[model samples]
Target: MDQRAAIPVTLPRDNPTQSYWQLEPDEIADLRSTSSLPDKADTVIIGSGITGAAVAFNLLSNGARDVVMLEARQACSGATGRNGGHTKAASYRSFLGHQKDHGTAMAAKIARMELANIRAVHAFARDHGIKCDSTPCDTVDVVYEAAQWELDQKAVKAMQDAMPDDDAAKYTLHSREDVWEKFFCGRGGDESVCGGVSYEAGSLSAYQFGVGVLKLCLAKGLNLHTNTPALNLEKLEGGGWKVETPRGVITAGKVVLATNGYTASVWKRFQGVIVPLRGHVTAQRPGLDMPKEGLPGTYSFIYEGGYDYMIPRPKGSKFEGDIVIGGALAKAPADGLEEYGTTDDTAFNEVIMKSLDECLRKYFGDNWGADNSEGRIRKSWTGIMGFSPDGFPFVGEMPGEKDLWVSTSFQGHGMVLCWMCARALVTMMGDGDEKELDAWFPEIFKINEQRLRLTFRGRLS
Candidate 1:
């Protein structure tokens, strides 16, 4: 059997491993607008994560009424809730590859879009007073390998040259000594520390942000149904689609699939194109010797094969000073190949868990000190992320499928991509001017016949 087809990318599983962000359930966590499923709607959105919330927000805010959203589990209980909450976009890491494939102008556009998306998210939160602890801070990418550090320097310089002068000014490079003294408290040596790059980034409670957005949409008369999985989709003869769910079927003029990792489950055409990859995360208490106020900002420890990203809980928050870290794919079996094409988030890999436990101790050295009363890790969990054959996400309408749209395959960078992607998608759905969207959104993200062919070929090969 083909390995990709053999792995099941089913619907979101029940009783998923608890994530640190979802500990305090929101009021709309299990919201069901009506006693039964609605028979019809102007628009139906599958998957109630950030993408779904953003799509509903855009639709309702633009005078589109009768929009319904469906969730397989509790609202915001997918990757958005389980991820390490950082709106940091490490675009430089892929700048060289993007430029080589698409060209300098497109690469620069991609980087700018990411930064703009981060700002939009923060601005939206502040404007709505959605108290999700959204904070803007400087995020650093600390290099641990000399060779990788050199490559990153070149990538950053190339990105800076391609981007606008104002955008380029946000990045700053540091020497190994500066990194050691500033970030590591003068701990790491030559072998462990190799310079760093700092840029404007942010950290927030994604679950809270998503739920808050949903609450606003609900106030505007958006219908939400939790624990309502979209089992399948069928095309209507005259127009629109019939979305089949366990409870009932909804005939909507438009159907929007915001399902990320489990998209293939309902849309079989994306089976191989959008592979599901399981990711792990942990919330750890700062050691006794660590600073009571926690580290200054968010961080990413970059090495040769993989990188680990982290964010500290806000000082006045309940889990103040606690570090939320994730990504140890290099240490996982087969360098994370074992995690691909899997949608199970109920359990985690022991090898990755062990590496996560040792991560802070290794980086902070003796200053990490002994564990607290509750030990190092307060909670650990897994989430499923959708990965496209190419790094870019698949947005806009599906070819040959009228009224059916999609905004998924975020490749675990949903924080920096979903909001804007959702906005652009809604614009296209409403027949808004494409040239206006073209000014900010990347054209490569649009779904076309050529992209679909290439994606299918790449998956099979």
Candidate 2:
């Protein structure tokens, strides 16, 4: 059988590795269009992913009214909803990449911003009652050691070297023994996290978080529309966007394009800019050794490990069942199932399923729960994020369009980056300095001066 045919969704589940919040199919939109938009508004935002929500939330918080949020699908169905529920205050693995490409200053600033996001999420949760099942558990970037691990450390130090003096305070360095005590004490070496960096952030329920976010937006009186895909988009006379949807037209003064990966056509030139990419995951019976419902909070990452994340729900400690997971669909397919070297996970395959089972077995040891077998693989999803030919993602104007901003291409790391992206975009669009932030921190965004042809375009470079 072809390896491509062996796609992980054997039972044909939906985004198998997704957590509890996303297990259910996305909620449908009720479109309070109980009435229509007043033909005009100061600003209108499209695509309701976390980024769009964050932008809406930030703008609302900043006292901007007449702000409306529209969702082509239900809120969060895009990357904001379909993403790994994992949340972090710092760039998890990409900080290293940030250091290499941008330099120390940018990298450090990105790191600190992540931490702030965690604080912001919790604060939002408490104040606004956005019940995303937010948690305070800190996450660890663990490694098994070796030169690669050290190089990752050097990236961290370079970040420290670039951060302002005050921002650098409270940074910690854990020894091998300390790492073990804090994370893997009494654990087997094969599963041991030899060394790691602790950052003050963890995962959240994406679906729940999205609902909370959307609900908040609704409360603010943001008009919403669903099942209304923006098929045709153009700039309006009053210096805004005119998006033609299947059901109605969305004309607004300022358009915040938050389509992570969907069918929203902004500019004819940006058609190929946001090509759709798919990612997958698998779930299994909890291992016997897996900590009970509420185990002390710890989100650990293993170097070279297939995937780096496993979070138990709040009930695990309170005595509710725990959800353990590892692995996302590995190889991105080239073209179709027969092709390789790309990410096309249309259906389930055995290769990923077996690999994930092995990872679960290894992490939990001989303790996987009996009868629990494997959780039913529920849904399969594909998200479209714009990718920068350069390794990192893009956040800024819509290539050739005026007054249009695009944030897409998350690779596999959208959760943390999305928030950072939204905040940065808002700042750039408005008059703001890094006042709340340190001066040593460099902005994470860079304008792509040269417009390259898109990957999905009919013609190639």
Candidate 3:
């Protein structure tokens, strides 16, 4: 697809909008491990979001030193910091389409792979002692549309029939008749009447996750330079590459592009393949009238023409009584496509914000925001996500660019994809063993000339 005509993706804008998660900044938010850019390094990772931090951490864990990471803005200042704080994987909602596109074998592989990614996130948090509010929770996919609910029910049955032995296959599905009882437990009143499937999921502060792991990597001699963008890249006469920046040029043996939405800025060939998509998220705190228990678990309002996801902050945490919700782009001005294709995320769209507000009120009832006595909307912010044409992230080495690896374009599912892909990418780099990598990564995620030749088909929502 010739996305060149659409809004072009560019470097992270200076003074980009701040997010609720980044309200209390971390010490390493703008840390530079070294006084200046290193003259040379064995590996240089770009974009210090979760992906870059994972790459650097895995490299150090595997005994590889002399690594450096460059970020255009503050650490974890991009989508990772601006996300809605949910790490949900695909369930029956997208199972049928995936099954048809990649056959049952790859489809099943993808399903299990996502589950593993979610588990890996929890394990990482526990192992590293990262207090990122990482919480294990169940996600209720609530479909308000009758037709879509029926279709979801059928898909759930099909998945159970196909993957009978898989542990995750036994997702508890609630029919429309029992949605209130199963989901709200009759607490939120008659207004709470939407439910479809409830599955295992997790939530965490993505900003803290990125920065916490990055601190561990820095202790192991990882040179990180924030506020430094890789403006231009060129192949050195020898075998490595030279990356130019306002600070200075740095040479590295291998370069990894962890710049999720802004990937096309450094690699022009990815102009259309890895498209930038803007999304909005809002944070709200419960008022005095609401119960302290609040909503039971995370939620996804699956409407016929729109959807919104929400993850409530853990109790007693810094943002204790707050909830972070994002989506409803379908209510945006331009069919949500124009909003998705755009690169700007400096402000929130009022139309979508209004829709999200209405959704919360409808689900929670009239007492939700009754004179700020229940829960009031605090703030709304936006962030850019990379939407892959094929609905999969572009991982592994660039098609023809040797030693140039990429782990971007996650289709707005970066939380579940970044850590696992980074681990597998580090393994592949340490040893050129395809069989080993095949065990960790699915074939659909690899980048190659064949996949690049295929036409682009927009895959949003």
Per-prediction TM-score to the true structure, in the order listed:
0.96, 0.77, 0.94
Count of clashes in candidate 1: 0
Tens-place lDDT per residue, model 1, 127-246, is 999988998898998898889989989998888777658573367899977877677633742247888999999999999999999999999999999999999999999999999999
Task: Please give the clash total of every predicted structure, in order.
Answer: 0, 32, 0
Q: Which stretches of candidate 3 lie over 4 Å from their true place?
A: 1-5, 185-194, 287-289, 366-375
* True-structure RMSD, every candidate: 2.1, 6.0, 2.2
Model 3 residue 325 lDDT? 87
Q: What is the lDDT of residue 419 in candidate 2?
A: 71
- How do the residues 329-359 of candidate 3 rate in per-residue lDDT, one tens digit apiece? 7787655766655667776677887876656
The whole-model lDDT of each prediction reads 0.87, 0.55, 0.80
> TM-score of model 2 relative to the true fold?
0.77
Best by TM-score: 1
For candidate 3, give the lDDT: 0.80
Q: How much is 310 displaced in model 3, in angstroms? A: 0.5
Error of 2 at 191 (Å): 5.8
Better of 1 and 2 by TM-score: 1
